[model samples]
Target: MQQNSLKLNSDKTQLLLIGSKSTLTKTNNLTLNIDGISVSPSHQARNLGVIFDSTLSLEPHIRQLVKISFFHLRNIAKIRPSLTPPTAEKLIHPFVSSRLDYCNSLLYGISNTSMNKLQLVQNAAARLLTHTKSWHHITPVLKDLHWLPVSHRISYKILTLTYKALHQLVPPYLSELLSPYQPHRSLRSTSARLLFTPTSKLRSFGDRAFSRAAPKLWNSLPILIRDSDSITTFQSRLKTHLFSSAYP
Candidate 1:
């Protein structure tokens, strides 16, 4: 009799863990029938069904399924892909609208406090699309405030993208910004300092017009020369190409 009672208690514990219930005859420990098969209560069984449904959505594209799985997986990839198309595109756009918006929101006194550096680049690029005249306004935000380093970084990454598009043609106000990177030391000396930094992209567009010649000449140079002279020349040239002001 004790062994049979132990078995009944163990079975009841298991059913309780699963939140099972049924209607039948009764004891304080178990619901039963007149036939005497004790069972769980009805409400418990229905609750379990609801729990399963809540855990998974039946949406097309398995949208919920992708989102839930990717939430934990963003570390491994641009799991943003799992987000719906509209949401993914929106996140890629920069959060701010104008220089004033950037100043108010993104330009905290200290650098580390900022978030959304990447988003700033995207939004800045979009603004540039309408106003290349405002490249002066946008470049510092990329170089000093927002701090990004790619044309490939996003569709319209700030400096490098603007560099590829305009080169020496970027405005004088913007060209002045390039002066710090010029080869000689001071801004006042930087006038003919452009001569020192032959690599300075901040030149007259006419001088830079044939500038694409370097790539073609690059292959003719020796491999060791490339690693040394090529790098030096490239760096100088890159500075000149990207930041030069003497273009139309």
Candidate 2:
């Protein structure tokens, strides 16, 4: 009887979730779409802000690249969030030659307007981290990201969601606000390793607090937070992009 009740509740939840396509598509469980067509409705839905678990069909290599790129971007922004474009690039240049796989994808696949996207992702990460209150829980899952096979749009949204999800684990000020608990050298070492190394372990957690909060949080953000293509351009395009069922 207890087993049946659990199954019944689970079925009802799935039905309620998928019944709303916009909500349905935002889930982190990636259903393989070797061809981009599967995401047509998602692309059009203009709600591309879903993260995925490694259990998804995505390849391991792409997952690794995505993880490396995510923290790298975060570290770059945090290191000197004030650096000028050219100077930032100069500091960024060394990493450009990284043997990491996404060099070509980030350059070729991501849109020119990604700076805004980065900011938005950062904001999302900040918000998510605030609620999470711990970094270890989020680190392990984040170690899995990729820009290649995941496709540009998919990677963009996935990264954004990942930031937001992990942010829920720790704090937005986490990267910025230093822990006095650690000595300066240890802090620097930890920062460098998290930023530079690809194989390092990020902390992980198993909690449903995120599940309860993410939908409301996502709904609160704009139809699109960043200008992957252009502010005005994507604004117009996303409307036509979504189905007749679309709404905030």
Candidate 3:
């Protein structure tokens, strides 16, 4: 910063130490001295509209999302009675769905409990659009709306990025994280489109990383979807595959 002639904004700056729960617990109260300023670690910090906690569980972000989503849901519900289904859906997508989908690829390996909280928000949004009763089944409503569940939505985002990375549509930093699997010897399955999955010793943390998760998800996809030549085609086929698995 000094070399770049950029002054630090101490008031707006935040320090967050990311690590496993055990490691974070042991390092509580850790502080850093930067240019004669004593900065303490925050349990959570906001970055690019996403909240990250010390342990990277993302519970803080989820909680904030749920709160904001419900606030919009309530506002939308107030006027849903006067709107057509299509109009209601259009309104909800921007306020609720977009927030759910924003940076959701980072949510790929979150706990089911956290995912359920987001699912409930989507369920409420779907119900608001269709005027469904609270006791009614949400799956059928979601399926009718052609909306993938929260989990599948996360996968869709990841797979889309993976496709872009493979095709050089994304930055080199992300593209370099993935490598196409090439067999040393020609075999019957040599035509299969697959990515080399890196070994991850820390399943809880490392497996959720884009480098590991992207390959794992990409490999699990059918060859037709993986072999798509264009991003548009890949997204269309990818959604159908994920929707089937989600609703099946």
Candidate 4:
């Protein structure tokens, strides 16, 4: 305020303490005062449409998505009998799947239980769009809609970001996280570039970091996909690859 000539809006200010479960437990009751205004700690905070919990578990976020998405899914399901598959898919993607994919990169390395919750939401969306029976296998339905499973969607988001970062299409903050994967003996003759995934002591947290997940997902791609010079081409091929993997 003194330097920039701007005043802090204490009333609108919120504080969040992020940490592991045990770490959060220790600071759960902690509080702070900024310029004599008490800043209460929040168990969960929403930033850029993504919810972050104290434990970084994302359960609250997932529950919120599930609640809102299912409301739309049910409403759409009621009207599905009167709509064509293409029309239903268009509505479903914007309303339901969009929510699932929003900021989903944060969900990288999340537990299977949490992944399953989102998957169920997507499965429901697919079935509702295609008017498939509840007992039908979801694999075929997802394939028909050309939709990647929830987990693959997350990876897709990460890898897409990674590609942009690698190609200098995104900001330095993201591009700095990636480094070309180098072999000890030098395999520089390879067609497409690979990325090195940094290791961390904190497995759960580290595993989900863009630095780790980006390279891991990047390296998993076929050489042709990785070698794609055009972002559009890469995304197209990557989606096809993921769709095949999901349904096959």
lDDT of each: 0.32, 0.34, 0.91, 0.86
Instruction: Specify the poorest-scoring 10-residue window by lDDT in model 2.
Output: 193-202
Runs in model 3 deviating more than 4 A are: none
Q: Between which residue pairs do clashes occur in model 3?
A: none
TM-score of each: 0.20, 0.20, 0.95, 0.92
Give the backbone clash total of model 2. 17
Model 1 lDDT on a 0 to 1 scale: 0.32
* Best of the candidates, lDDT: 3
Residues 1-248 of candidate 2 have per-residue lDDT tens digits of 56666333321121112223344556765443322323212222111222223222122333444455566656775855466545654544355223232322222223334333333333334323233344344332222211122222333333344233333534554323211123346554342212111121211211112332233323333434322344345334333333111221
> Which candidate, 2 or 4, would have the higher lDDT against the true structure?
4
Select the stronger candidate by lDDT from 1 and 4: 4
* lDDT tens per residue, model 3, 151-177: 999999999999999888999999999
Q: Looking at candidate 4, what is the lDDT of residue 73?
A: 89
Candidate achieving higher TM-score, 3 or 4: 3
Give per-residue lDDT, candidate 2, residue 16: 14
